[model samples]
Target: MDHTTAETQLLDAADTLFYERGIQAVGMDAIRAASGVSLKRTYQLFPSKEHLVEAVLRRRDLAIRAELEAYTSARTTPTERILAVFDYLYEWFRQPDYRGCAFINSFVELGAGSENVAEIVRTHKRAFADHIAALVAAADLPPARVGQLLILANGAMVTAAIAGSPEPAREAREAAQRLLDEGVPD
Candidate 1:
């Protein structure tokens, strides 16, 4: 395969392994074997395992952002778009291979002092929150309320991932509906 394809494959493999297992638990050899690429090639693409882990997280963030954008685009109303976010996440949680949030898992695995990984995780999280904030703004909610709603949505995702159940997403959706109704009066 070409260089781009090879790198993509390596990222894909790393994403799966790192998400299912943990960054610390998964080694370069495992990524090479799983990607069907040589160790030399993997090293050439990433230079270090930490870099590879970051690539995996970046790829996942891109994919999820695309999914969320597509989900929001199909609906006419902002409320539908807001509800769609939670609905999409609930479906994601049902995936057979789902093992909770990869970034959260990596954070737990890498511990608190790993600034590099923490930076990547924080960037991805801020992007998600920003997306929610934009959506809330478009819906015309007050700025303070929009920020509060964004926190609630993000907290719901993390809670669901940690709880290993969809209940949090469901309840969060209900709570979100209540908040929106109170704020926007739909």
Candidate 2:
């Protein structure tokens, strides 16, 4: 296989293993074995376990952001874009292999003080939240109200993950719509 394909296969293998098992539990040797790549090749791609973990997270972030952008593009109104996020997340929750937020799970495994992992997690989360905030701003909502709605939207994802159900996400979307309707100036 080509280099890009090999790298993608490695990341796919890592994502499955890391998400199902914890990052700490899956070692580089295991990833190499699973990917059917030689140790030398694996190390060449990812010098350390930390680098592999970051690659898995970065891949996931890119896929999720792409999904959000595609979903939002179908809607003309900001409110629809906001609600589309819920629809996107709900679809993800319905997948049989769904294992909640990778970033949140990784953060739990790495704990609070891990600088590199924490930076990756924080950056992904802020980007998602900022996307929602931008949509709220486009709807002409005040900054404070936009922040509140974004929190509600993000809270929905966390709640759905914990509950292992999409109901919490649906509830959050409804509440966010109500907040927007009431809080947006006329």
- Cα lDDT tens digits, model 2, 51-162, are 8898888888888888888898689888788788777777877766667788988898894757788888998988888788788778787777667766766676678777
- Supply candidate 2's per-residue lDDT for 173: 75
Backbone steric clashes in candidate 2, count: 0
- Per-model lDDT: 0.81, 0.81
TM-score of each: 0.90, 0.90
Q: 90-119 in candidate 1: lDDT tens per residue?
A: 888777777778877778777486788888
After superposition on all C-alphas, the RMSD of every candidate to the true structure, in Å, is: 2.3, 1.9
Best candidate, lDDT: 1
